[model samples]
Target: MIRSVVFDIGETLTSDTRYWADWARWLAIPTHTMSALVGAVVAQGRDNADAIRLIKPGCDVAAEWHARRTAGQDEYLDETDLYPDVRPALQRLRDAGLWVGVAGNQNHRVGDLLRGMKLPADAIGTSSEWGLAKPDRRFFDRVAEWAPGERHEIVYVGDHPANDITPGRAAGLRTAHLRRGPLGHLWADSPAVAAADWRAISLHDLADQLTSRPGGAVPAPSM
Candidate 1:
């Protein structure tokens, strides 16, 4: 039985449109350009840092983030940044006696953002504090530490097939590939994505499945 559900931050539980738009505004580029660049990167299964580097050759991601912080931007998520389905889905999971947490390749500010938003999460971990990012087995391993039982007792929900689902499955956790983020529409037919234990268009679908299932153990998706 799944005892914990850990989620990815960007494009998974939160809609990052405003966040990315902030970055674009700071960089003096059109927001649509940045949005398209992000989608392109996701479609190619590339990293966001790598995409940023490509946009501004020789740029430093950490330095850019620090600059944004200094400028009083990129601080936290606004109320409009979160997806409509996130709160209700998380609540439903908690009501079903399951642990809900957030784990992702996000900066330290994300923890503050989720907390400020008053999310009903048991724990929130980010790459900045964890010193590891997704697709790295260590990240998933860290999440396993917070779960009740063995690694398989947890389910990882996220949008990236390569970064989220692939490594998660390798770490012995069931995976849910969400079709809402950058990789959703473009990579839907990819072989890696097809292997996920579940494919959901929204968190609500997963919530419904867990609530209906005995012991909150999500069943395999019908082929």
Candidate 2:
């Protein structure tokens, strides 16, 4: 049986894209313009830090953007919200005897985001704190350490193809892709799988897959 369910924080459990898009607009940069810049960086296969560097003005703008988003820290903690069905799904996983945890590449503020959402502290993990991010085998190794037992018993859910699905699959865990936007092209080469909102699939689907016999777990070939 699936003993644990690991999740990626951004996009998978929370929606921060709107906040970033709105921040860009407030800074007088068009949303699509910023998107194009990001697209170019991705197309070049730049790392996250490199991509962030290419977007000039750096953390100052990021801080300002976040500050505005949270209304100058007055409402900073209040700005974060869980995906619509996230809480219920997590509860279900926990109730079903599956260990639920989070693993993501996030800044220091990630802790704050989790606190704001009231997610249990014991279930969370982040790359910034872990010193490694997704797609890196180390991240999965750490997760394996946290949960213990069989690697095949874990199911990882994430939004990015490279960061989440590819590495999770490589690490021997079942993988679930949370389709949000234009990621289809990235996974175009992969076999097809079902899609669901936070409420639709719930953690039960994940639990069912991971607990299945070897090779019974659905293949999530990288796109």
Candidate 3:
């Protein structure tokens, strides 16, 4: 039985428009241009961060972030960024006696913001806090360590194919590939999502699927 459920942050639980818009403002580029570059890179199977480099070659992203913090231009997430479905979905899962958490390829500042929001998650962390990022098997290894119980008992849900579904499965956990957000829609019909334990349109759908399974528990996977 699946005893735990962990979630991805950006585009999974939260809309990332504010994030990209802030970066565009910082770079003095039009938001539409930033969006276009982001879509281009994602469609090409490249890291979305490459869009920043495309706008300003030789720019060090980490250094730029530090500079922004020093200049008091730091941006952070809050309830406003969260999807309307996020709270009730998490509540439903937790109410069903599943352990819930939020983890993803976010920075420490984002980690702080999530903590402040005080969502239903029992645990929350980010790439910067764990010093690990997804699409790396080692990062999923860390997730396994952070979550409770055996690997098979935990299901990771996210909208990213490579970062969330692929790595979470490689780490021996179940995966739910959510068909929301840019990456989600782009890869919705692809083979990458085909292997997921569940394909969901929203967190509510995932919650219902998980909660309504046989015996009111997520069915055990075949060995």
* Candidate with the greatest lDDT versus the true structure: 3
How do the residues 87-164 of candidate 3 rate in per-residue lDDT, one tens digit apiece? 999999999998898999988889999999999999999999998999899888887888887888888899999889
Cα lDDT tens digits for candidate 1, 7-122 = 99988988878877787887888888888888777666677666577679899988998898888776568678889988889999999998898989887778777877888788
Each prediction's total of clashing residue pairs, residues at least 3 apart in sequence or on different chains, is: 0, 1, 0
Error of 1 at 218 (Å): 6.5
lDDT of each: 0.81, 0.61, 0.87
CA shift of 70, model 3, Å: 2.2
Arranged by lDDT, best first: 3, 1, 2
TM-score of each: 0.90, 0.70, 0.93
Ranking by TM-score: 3, 1, 2
lDDT (tens digit, per residue) of candidate 2 on 1-223:
5677788876677765664465456556777766666666655656533434555555565565467657653222234446666676677667666678887887656756675566642467678888987779989888888874588777677767777777777777766776543342444334433321111133344444444432344543333
Off by over 4 Å in 1: 214-223
- lDDT winner between candidates 2 and 3: 3
- List clashing residue pairs in candidate 3: none
Task: In model 2, state the lDDT of residue 177.
Answer: 71
